[model samples]
Each structure stands twice: as structure tokens, then as C-alpha cells.
Target: MRFVLAPSVLALSALGLAASPALAAQEFYVGEPVMKEGLQIVPNYLTGIQMSAHVPGMEMGKDAIHLEADVHAGKDEAHSLAEDTWIPYLTIKYQITKKGSPLYHKSGVLAAMVAKDGLHYANGVRMDGPGTYRLTYVISPPKLYRHVDKASGVPDWWKPIKAAWTFQYPSKSK
Candidate 1:
């Protein structure tokens, strides 16, 4: 009876241990996924910014500025069931132009950053997978200087400009 009971008890223990890993995987992947807001989210699904950035006849000028950036992160989940994961990302930016020689350069252009955080669980343990995360962003905004003809020290054909591309996240006000 003792020998039989020993095997059963050990098997039960193993099963309990196994349950931990699957539950743990959610620690990392649970909050974050391909679609945080939901599949097929519309312009009004998010929150944070104002309108005119979304609609027309707004305070912002017709032709706003633009920017782009990319990020690549590789992860090694030696203990994880999947073993590895990688995510490639990109974002397009928008801004308004300098209006009547705005004093601060940063105000003319927005300073921004975006980062991704991740976690993994295996064998009832939580682990930070090697290189599974990254910080990618556009720190330096564009120059808003008036076009100057160096030789003549005079303005170019275009007028002085205040430019910025505002990407207003959709909200209650639309």
C-alpha cells in the first residue's frame, strides 16, 4: 500500500506543478495583445487628444507635418513553451507648423516616446525573457525655422510657418 500511495502522491504533485506554467504565461501576454482596444477599432475608439486633429475647418492648418519610426525586438524564451517571440512595429506622426515665430522649438515639434513591456512564466516561475522588450521613439522634433536665403539674409518665397501634426486620439467629443 505504501509503494502504491507514493507513486500516486508524486503524480499529483507533478500535476499541480504543471498547472503553474500555463497560468503564468498570462502574466506577460495577458494585458497586452495584438489588439488592446479590440479588433477593428474605429477612429473614435481611443482617448487622449482633441478634435480638428481628427476633423476639418479646425484651428490646425490644412497641411500638417509628418514623421515615422520603427522598432524591432527579439526574445529568447528558453524555458517558455514557444521558445521565442519577435515583434516589429512602426508609427506615423503628425504636427502643426510654427505660427508667427513661436519661441520654443520643442513646442513647434512634439517630443515623444513609446515602449513595450513583457513577461513570461514557466514551471510556476516568472521570467523576464532576454531581449523581449524595447523602447522605440522619435525624440527630436523637426526644425521650424523660417526659410532664409543665406546670401541675402532675407526670407524665402514662403511665409514664416508654425507647424505641428497633432494626432488626436478619438474621444467623447469626437
Candidate 2:
């Protein structure tokens, strides 16, 4: 009985070890969600993911982190958009600055992408090193052409909004 139990436990341990890397790829929130201009924006980061086989962008690397903006409609929104519904056709740009250091700065526009979780804007950024950094996302309303009748027209989209947060690199939580 002892020999059989030992083998079972060893197999389970091996399985757990094998699964650790997958679990490590999970995302972690950078800060609390920010609600503004009838929108809720949540910032998160995780291990860099492969965007394309030939694209020169964020990919799994020692210093790469995948940044994401989970943009959705907020409660109290006057527009007909449902709360928590993912907003589409918006432009999102990200800027990263190393806290208290003027030497390191990077900025780029996030591309719209869909994952198993949902639609969001994201980009891959390579960090200088482990340290506290500030991430700011500038969001702009959709620019798609739409005809609005007088009876069905809603208010114009909100102005570009900025959401910012500071977080530690090599996120301790992950």
C-alpha cells in the first residue's frame, strides 16, 4: 500500500510542476479599474504572448510584458451601450515611464485583439529592468462612420480619456 501511494503522489507532483508555467502566464491587475467618461478601464499585464510569427512586437522574452486595457461601458452611461460591454473601434495608446528616471521611456499604440476572455486593446512592451513604473493609456472614441437619425441619435462620444497607474515590474503577484 505504501509503495502504491508513493508512486501516485510522485505522478501528481510531476503533473503539478508541468502545469506551473501555464499558471504563471496568467495576468495580474496593475491597479483598480478606473471609471471615467462613461467607461471603465482596467489595466493588466502578463507574460508576453506571441502576436505573430513574423511581426516584430511583443513576444515571450525575459524582459517582455504584455500590457492590456480592458475597456467597457460603465454604469450611469447615458448612451444605449450596456454596462460592462466591451467598447469597439476605439484607439488606445500606451506610454511607460520608469518612475523617477528620465532615461527610460516607451510609447506605442495598442492594437485591438480578442482572446478567450474577451475583446480588449493590448500591446507588448519590453522593460528596462525590474522597478516601479508608470503606465498611462490614452483612449479615444471610435472613428467609424455612422449615420444617426434625429430620433435615434445619441450624444457625441466622450472626449479622449486618460487612465494611469503605477506598478512594480516583474510583478510580485505573478
Candidate 3:
């Protein structure tokens, strides 16, 4: 009797698990890339990096906005080898243009790989309602390669560059 009942319960549990909405697939937004010189910067809704913005367990606070930037060698395949080997530093400057909110206007270096594709950056900004924001990302190549010759693994096209992207966060209520 116990064996018969266990099989029925297990089958029902499997059906419920398949019907759960939390297990459904989610679609994430990836922004367009802005080019400057030979570097490329792409923005996205979320990245693999995880960081604490405010006090833990606080419900009422600035919303968490996960941002990421991926730097590429260029369109050509000549620098493909340098993509994974070369590690560069990046600084992200962000500002909320809608109003002078203390939580929104801030700048810092997004110097974490936390992701395989590229550098990851994330923070909790004052985006409780909705507003326009501007972000400028500056990518500086590693100093170790500065003196290294191109033949010794360094790409000849490597250099520091700046890319900017301005976007608006829609109101959550609407």
C-alpha cells in the first residue's frame, strides 16, 4: 500500500513542478553597443556579478540596477587572441538626469569579471519611480602590456577609449 501511494504522489509532484511559473523561462534585455576608436561597449539588464548596494533585508530603498560592459578588440579577427588574455580596467560614471537624487548620482570603477563574456558592474540606483540616466564607461588597457611588444602577445590596436550611452528607465507603475 505504501509503495503504491508513493508513486502517485511523486507523479503529482512532478506535474506541479512543471506547471510552476517560477520555473518558466525569462527574457533579459541587452542594449546596443557604442563604439569609440577600436573599443566597443555593450550594456545589458543584468550581469553575472553580484554585489550588495544597501543594508541587507531593507525593503524600502533604491532599486538594484544591474549593468555590464563588454570590451572587444574590434570587428576583425586579428585581435581574437587578445580578448581572453588581456585584462583591462573600466570605470563607469552614472548620473540620474531626472532630478538631483543622492542615490542616483555616483561614479565608480566597474572592475570585476564576475562574468565570462566581459567585465561586470552593478549597483542600486535611485530608480524607484522612473527617470533618465547617463552612463559613460572608460576602458583603460592593462599597464603590463603598455611596454610589451605586439609580437609578444599584445595587440597593436590596444588603446584607451571612452564610450557613452544614455537611456531612460520606464516607470514601473505604468
Candidate 4:
């Protein structure tokens, strides 16, 4: 029997570890459409460098898609922090405005991908060499959203919280 673990399921299974906010910095994209959905496989911060586009200033939109290859982790401990000690991670970022999904709150998932473990899940497929992985994802509430600030109660740019995948690299250490 085959089962697909949806992104929400995967997020709950890992107890939010795979997509832990503590594991990564929250990415906010401005000028994103009120509603957006798509797949993106971005380079983990550990890959010897940060993708220029991922930098804070780069403009992202609802239709933006990126496919990154040549994956190799950096040695710096801080940069590797994003992997959450997990390597071969594919970082997928998406944003949604509050107008997209009604009743949208932080109680649900943001983004996720599935491995052999199941749909919208974590871990690797035990494959060798750099392989292309299809990142199937889902943004809950089916709409756009944004986070309100604590100090000022000011909601920043409309965005769906970022979700990351740390596909354990083929390492015996892990």
C-alpha cells in the first residue's frame, strides 16, 4: 500500500523540527501576490555560499521558481545551522498575503516536501550522487497571509511562513 503524507502531516510528524523556526531565519517576501502556490528547490545556506537571490533585498513574486544544483555543504558551523544538523536539505520558500486565505493563522503548515518516508515529509530516498528531487508542496488555508509584529502589532509584508526540508545527506554520521 502507498500512502502520501501531506505537508501538514509531515509538519506534525517531525513536531515542527524539520520546519522549525528556530532552525532557520524567517524569510519575508514583499510584493507577493495576495495568493500564490508553486514548487521551489533552493540551495541550503551551507552550500559554500548563499544564493544571491535569497539575499534580503531580492524581489520575489507569486510566479517565481528556482531550481538549484551542484549541492555541497559549507564547513562553517553557523551556515550549516540551517540544515539543523541535517544535510542535503532543500529549502523551499513561499509567501501568501492575509487576503489569500481567510481565517489563516500560524496554527497550520507553511511549506514541506516528501521523501521515501511519505508525501510532504522529510528524510532521503537513499539515492547516491546529486539527484533531482521533485518538491511537492502545499500552503495551508489555501490563501495568502502575513505575521503581525509583537511590539507594534504591525503585520509585515503579506507572506506565508517559510518551510524547509533537511534531506539527510548520505552521511554515516547522521
Candidate 5:
């Protein structure tokens, strides 16, 4: 009446157990990824933190939520950027509003950051509590000057792009 697991299975089980803590540390609610102007934008959120210690120029506060944006190059062959590459040096601004409210609950520019998940823009915001809310992101092109040869230059960056999503706070998984 005894069961035995294969060596490979045991190894996989040990690896999963070892990685669970890092994977379960943060539970996030992710919005649908939007594609526009040759770029893909994804919005997500998790519990907030006192990030001043880690990020330069970030204020210290116990914000309600840590919002993030993942911007990547779209699958467009015309552009020089490789598909799914993280696009850096761009300005991203976020605004949050309750679904039924006319006024914005919070709004600010997100700082570029690197985390376990990779490069993205993120910021903290204090929420009024759990509810349905609308999140909007306005992305501006990278401002760095690039020296390009006429034959090798890529197409110009897209104009300011806006993407929005509505998500419920205190998501079911969280």
C-alpha cells in the first residue's frame, strides 16, 4: 500500500517547493495587455510598499497599491525593435478613478524600475478602498537622442499613446 515517486519527480517537487516563496510573495491583479502604435502595454497591481529606500526621488509613504506598466515592442516587422523587447527611456503616466466616480482618485508619473519580473514602470498610489476602478496610462516616446545612419535608422517612435483598463480591487486571487 506504499507509493514511490521517480527521482525526476522528486527533484521537480523539491525545486517547486524551493521557489514557491518567491513566487507567492506577491499576488497581483493583471489587466489585459493592449497593443497600439507598434507597442504592447500591460497594466498590473499588487500591495504597495515604502519604496523610497530602493528608488531614487521616490517619496516614502504607505500607499495602498503598487501599480506597474510593462511596455514591449510589438510584433511589427517594419520596426527595428525586436518583438517583445522591453522599451526603455519612455515616460509613463497613470491615472486611477472609481468606476462610477467622475474625478480621478490618483494620478502620477511612474518611475522606471527593475524588479524580479524585469524592467517596467511603476508607482505607488493610495486608494480609497476596494472597488471597481479605471486605470489609464499615457506613454510618451523615449527622449534620448539617437545617432542613426540613413540606411540603418529605424522608424520614428510613435506619438503619445493612451491605454486604459477597468479592474476590481481586492481581486479574487488576492
Candidate 6:
């Protein structure tokens, strides 16, 4: 006997495959510094800073994104790391853009790092349900000195960067 598949069934199957974890694995990318909010946010790779992120496996009621970062003096470091020098403040701003969903745009500041010196990590950023999301990482460095922008009043720093990645969040509709 021969079997035939219906269009609806085919479409559903394709969707299921697309939502598989293998296709939605963790994503990583490097960001280049840009002037924004009057600070230089350099990428870990370039500024002797190390950063990484991972998407936790989707569970019955929980899915999160974990991140870690570390900073050290690079070859020709820009800022002074002398003993008495003030520690440069580091912060991360994240935004999630959902393609076709009623969910409104979501963004917030990550909790302060538990470890202060260099190494930094967080539990993870939570998502609203599951679907395709565009994640943007905006790293902000300490403002030791600023170059004021006459037009916008926003100052510029040594090095600021932005990074982006797109990934699908598996839904629980299997």
C-alpha cells in the first residue's frame, strides 16, 4: 500500500523540524565599538575582554540565556589599570525582537555581576514564550573621559561596540 501526505501535515512537520534544539543552539558573535550614550564599549575579542553566551535548553516552563565576560589589559591597553585607577564600569543592555508575535518589544538591564574583578556571569535572560528572536548586545564601558557631541549632547568614548544574533526558540506545541 502507498501513503500520501496532506499539505497541512507537511507544513506542521516542517515547523517541528525547524523548532528542534539542534537548529536553535546557542549563538555567538563579535561586536565592534561605536559611540552611544557617551561611552566606549569595546568587544571582548579586541579590548582584551572575553565574552560568551549560551541558550539554555527549552523546558516545560523555563528557557534562559546565559552570559559571561572577563576583562584584562590588551597589547597597548587604552585605559589606565594602575592600582589607584578607578575600575571602569561595565554594563550590558539587551533587547529581544520577536518577528510575528503579539508580544511587545522587551528590553532590560542585566543584574549586577556577583564577581566584581574581571570575571562576570549572570543566571540568564528570560524570554517571553518561544519563537524567533533577534538578540542585540550593547556593551557599555566606564566613562573616564568623554568627547561631547555638540549636536546630540551625547559624548564619545575610546571604543564602544554592538553585537547581534538571530535564533529560533522552540515552542512546546509538539
- Tell me the whole-model lDDT of each prediction, alpha carbons only: 0.22, 0.77, 0.46, 0.28, 0.72, 0.43
| Predictions: Cα RMSD each | 22.1, 6.8, 9.2, 19.4, 8.5, 14.5
Cα lDDT tens digits for candidate 4, 59-110: 2332222212112223332232232233223343332223233443222112
| Residue-by-residue lDDT tens digits, candidate 2, 33-125 | 998988899999867354544234644566778788998898877667899888889899899999778988989888888766778788788
In terms of TM-score, which candidate is stronger, 5 or 6?
A: 5
lDDT score for residue 119 of model 1: 19
Worst 10-residue lDDT window, candidate 4: 26-35
Candidate 1, residue 171: lDDT = 11
**Deviation (Å) of 56 in candidate 4:** 33
- Top model number, lDDT: 2
TM-score of each: 0.16, 0.80, 0.54, 0.17, 0.75, 0.41
Worst 10 residues of 5 by lDDT: 18-27
Q: Can you write out model 1's per-residue Cα lDDT over 99-168, one digit (the tens) per residue?
A: 3334412212122232222211101111122222221122221233333556544332222222222222
**TM-score of model 6 relative to the true fold?**
0.41
Residue ranges of candidate 6 with Cα displaced over 4 Å:
1-61, 67-76, 80-88, 114-118, 121-123, 143-156, 170-174
Q: Mind giving the per-residue lDDT tens digits that candidate 6 earns over 59-136?
A: 122344443233333433333343223224666676667788656475654433433243442335455656777767
Ranking by TM-score: 2, 5, 3, 6, 4, 1
- Taking the tens digit of each residue's C-alpha lDDT, what string does model 5 give over 29-116? 6688898888889888755343434544343343366778988988993457799899889999888898766664778899887766
Q: How many residue pairs clash in all the candidates, one count each?
A: 13, 0, 0, 14, 0, 7
Evaluated with TM-score, which candidate comes out highest? Answer: 2
**Candidate 6 or 5, higher lDDT:** 5
